[model samples]
Target: MRCWAIIPIKGKGEGKTRLAGVLSASERDALVDAMLAHVVQAAGQAGSIERVLLVGPSRHGLDGAIPLLGDPGTGLNTALGAALDTASGGALAAIGAEGPDRVVVIAGDLPCVTALDLDLMAQVPAGTLGIAPDRHGTGTNALSLPLPDASRFIFRFGADSRALHQREAERLGLAVETICSAGLEKDVDEPADLTDAAPVFTPAR
Candidate 1:
């Protein structure tokens, strides 16, 4: 199936505020940039992902290889909704080509996410939604949905988002398949999360 990956990134210097106690403004900015790059690379490397698109305030210092959509600035859900619309050919005709069979929505802060994790998520059967919850099993780290049904899917992405998404999927009568993987479950949000992902943030020798 043709799959498209959409990564929603907050504007530069606008994320990881929870880690302010441990990370300076510049440190947080750099962390966000690094995480975005890692996620983009993993998406690009995933064989199932045909296209990788970014939705954010500005592309700015991004790698520039992937296409970028301006964030609607309404909120996370709005940004994700716009990306889904684009993938459905309702917008961004330049990036829409026959539309994608499946759309994967991944958080930009998943530094540990690998191409294999993405490939596994893409394996969800038709008419089913694949979800990868964060370490605490409260927040959602990754989500995959069929293109036709994605437009109507509600994106509940904060505070117990895993349960919210599961309930929403059930309400929509869609099968929910949980994709559990260490890589997909780890996301950099609070200071503890950052510390846990320290190995990834470190530069190679």
Candidate 2:
């Protein structure tokens, strides 16, 4: 029952288009760093997860603690394909971590995701998939599957990703569970989105 978490991050100055107006350039970059830190911290705490993979293209001034994988110089689909291939081919095999009995793919923008959310995502029954809807309830923020290959659901990040996931799940004949956890639903995408949630990177008291 080993699991891995895949987090795809688009480096700063290129990510979070909607938040540009709400925060200064430095603020946005700092926010991205804080979000990545929170995600890494939560993934480390999730007892169910054995490893965390950061998938994204290489860029200057990018610092993350988890192992980084160079994103394939292609679109989102190709980047994901590369990650799955790594997990399926020999990387995980060599480490004795089998082809993810469970895999959790989470958005890097979600700063509020807690260890509890990771636990819940990893608790799905075998042969089923679990997804957490975004704040608008139209997009996907978190998705968990027993096996990566079983997830043929394409990500359409624009408007109705939730609907797209449901449709794909139905097509693949896989049972799906939809959850709206507070941590999973909120992400820093738009200016209003940041305003809606408190800053996640407060100094330790």
Candidate 3:
């Protein structure tokens, strides 16, 4: 199946605000950059993913050829929804394709995410919704939606999002398959989350 990955990322010097108490502003900024780069590399390396699209400002400074879409200066849910609509509605025409068979939406803050983890999510059965919940199994870290089947699925990224996404998949009449892996489950959010991403916070990068 032709799989595409959509990563919703904040612009430069953004995100990781919850860790402000533990990390200095500069430290948080570096960590955010590191994690976004890691996620983008992983998505690009995934053999099952045909393309990797970023939804955010174009100021990430990734030092690579990447396609970026404007964030619309709104919440993540709204940003991601617009990205999906663009990917499925008419943007494919520009790429000389109809649409992807599977669409994988992965958060940009997952420093631990790997190509294999993304591949696992993309390989879910047709008509199945693949969800990778956070380590606590409460929030969602990554998702794989089967084509037009889930093109309009709502994104619930906050509290209980894992369960909320599952319910949304059911409402869309798609089977739910949970992809659990260390790489896909870890996401740094707060001061307590720093330990999980300590290796990824190289400020000199």
Clash pairs (backbone) in predicted model 2: none
- Residue by residue across 45-68, what tens digits does model 1's lDDT show? 999998889888876487777788
Q: Is candidate 1 or candidate 3 better by lDDT?
A: 3
Model 2: how far residue 30 lies from native, Å: 0.9
Q: Residues 4-106, candidate 3, lDDT per residue (tens digit)?
A: 8999888656788887777778888888888888999899999999988888876478755577766878789988988888777756655455578889999
- Clash totals, every prediction: 0, 0, 0
Taking all chains together, each candidate's TM-score versus the true structure is: 0.94, 0.86, 0.93
lDDT for model 2, on a 0 to 1 scale?
0.74
| Per-residue lDDT over 1-205 for candidate 2, one digit per residue giving the tens place of the 0 to 100 score | 8788988878556766676666767777677777877887788899888888888875334454456777767766577667766665546554455577777888877878898898889888887878899988888888886675454555555578788877777777789998778899998787667753465753222
* Ten-residue stretch with the least lDDT total in model 3: 89-98
Winner by TM-score: 1
Ranking by TM-score: 1, 3, 2
Q: What is the C-alpha lDDT of each candidate?
A: 0.85, 0.74, 0.86
Query: Could you tell me the lDDT of residue 72 within candidate 3?
Result: 78
Which candidate wins on lDDT?
3
Ranking of predictions according to lDDT: 3, 1, 2
- Winner of 1 and 2 under TM-score: 1
